[model samples]
Target: MKKLNVTEIQEKPEGFVASVKEELNVELARTLKAGNRMLVDSDGLAFIYIIEDELDYYYVSFGKGTWPSLKKLLANQGSLDLELGNSLNIELTAIADELAFLTENIEGNSNYGEEMEKAVSDIFL
Candidate 1:
């Protein structure tokens, strides 16, 4: 799947939402809720636990100070669904890129690792 530019995402909400649901095995309601949470907050750190939880199902390994790194990995993986490919009208690419960078460049204690792990487990339960 080709990586979408941010503009393509903003212009087509239905398509974007649909693709995310299909690829992530997430319902539209859940995706929308998560997306809204991401949008309302500028810091990706707030979403670390959520993202970590989601990734657990895929068996991806994440390390301390690796939240940003994981975002980059997801962005690189990109979307394979056709609906999302067509809905590329928003600035989501840049937003995604920024989030990836933030995640990759973050410097701090690794205490959040356990917290994120627990949060992921709880959410999945």
Candidate 2:
């Protein structure tokens, strides 16, 4: 189960690489991050990235409204609601292999122990 990279995900017809240019008027080719999970349904192409512990990010494009780093879908936030959009229909977690790899790689590289130790040492000073 090889983890899918951003380029592969963008190549799909459901992807918004073109839509992003047409809709949002932004070029995303250079800035798009590797997706941890992706899903394509009738609604649109939706993808997710594990930004950090307990912090996840998402983007969905219906050939129209397209945005990234959305905390929650808002009318003004992007153009659709997470619950109402393709996310609900497309389970990102179903990509277990990618999810597992993403979590392990992202979390494994975190310097939580070092940061915590530094915080503790600074607390008494």
Candidate 3:
């Protein structure tokens, strides 16, 4: 498949992100970083890229920011009653449901439009 030049992806990414992904999976799979840099994010979005290898590969990621609310709710579970706990539970379930969308590898690429849209929007902004 044809790939988007790194400069286009880095600079003028204004089209639908799925389209961009169709054109840039090879680039992203090779160029994106692999972990959260909470420390570096004050300066910008801490992009973490990871390239796939045999026996170890992944596509999408939900970093600390994505699950912190659920983590906090679970950590403070003792302080919540049924009503509050139900609400927190709902939020936690949602976070888990959202995270469950991540695939083990490129097997899920065709369905990554939602995530790609969010990531590309964040990066291009």
Candidate 4:
């Protein structure tokens, strides 16, 4: 599977979450329109979590898929209850290996890393 380099959002937690949603929505639309099946390993989710990890932008607390899942919290408002539990534990693992290529490929060439970062960052801001 190919990897996606998502830009690291250097802003407040809310900013990061909003940015992820916006990026994901756009990418999802584009991917679907292109007739590409969006597997868990697709670039869209990878772009989301990798940026989340790099930013450490979790509002309550930063975890693996905290950013994307938190962004999803609003849509799943009923899921989260008076007490946070399993509902809050959104799985970001599925798409993680997708981004491994971005991190791993840096070993061979520095320019590739720079370009990848730029591509991810340009997804939004």
Evaluate all candidate structures by whole-model CA lDDT and list the values in order.
0.29, 0.28, 0.26, 0.30
Give the distance in Å from residue 104's predicted Cα in candidate 4 to where it truly belongs: 2.1
Off by over 4 Å in 1: 1-18, 22-91, 105-107, 110-114, 117-125
State the weakest 10-residue window (summed lDDT) of model 2. 16-25
- Relative to the unseen true structure, what is the C-alpha lDDT of residue 117 in candidate 1, on a scale of 0 to 100? 41
Candidate 2 regions exceeding 4 Å error are 1-82, 85-88, 110-125
Clashes found in each candidate (C-alpha, N, C closer than 3 A): 18, 0, 6, 2
Segments of candidate 3 deviating more than 4 angstroms: 1-91, 103-108, 114-125
Residues 14-122, candidate 3: write the lDDT tens digits: 2111111123334334433322111111122222222233434333222324333323333343121111111221011222222223322213343445455354334
Error of 1 at 67 (Å): 8.7
State every prediction's TM-score relative to the real structure: 0.24, 0.22, 0.17, 0.22
Decreasing TM-score order of the candidates: 1, 4, 2, 3
lDDT of 2 by residue, 92-122 (tens): 3323354234334334333434443333223
Which one wins by TM-score: 2 or 3? 2
User: What's the lDDT of the predicted structure labeled candidate 4?
Assistant: 0.30
In Å, residue 113's CA in model 4 sits off its true spot by 6.1
* lDDT leaderboard ranking: 4, 1, 2, 3
Query: What are the C-alpha RMSDs, in order, of all predicted structures?
Result: 13.0, 15.5, 18.3, 14.1
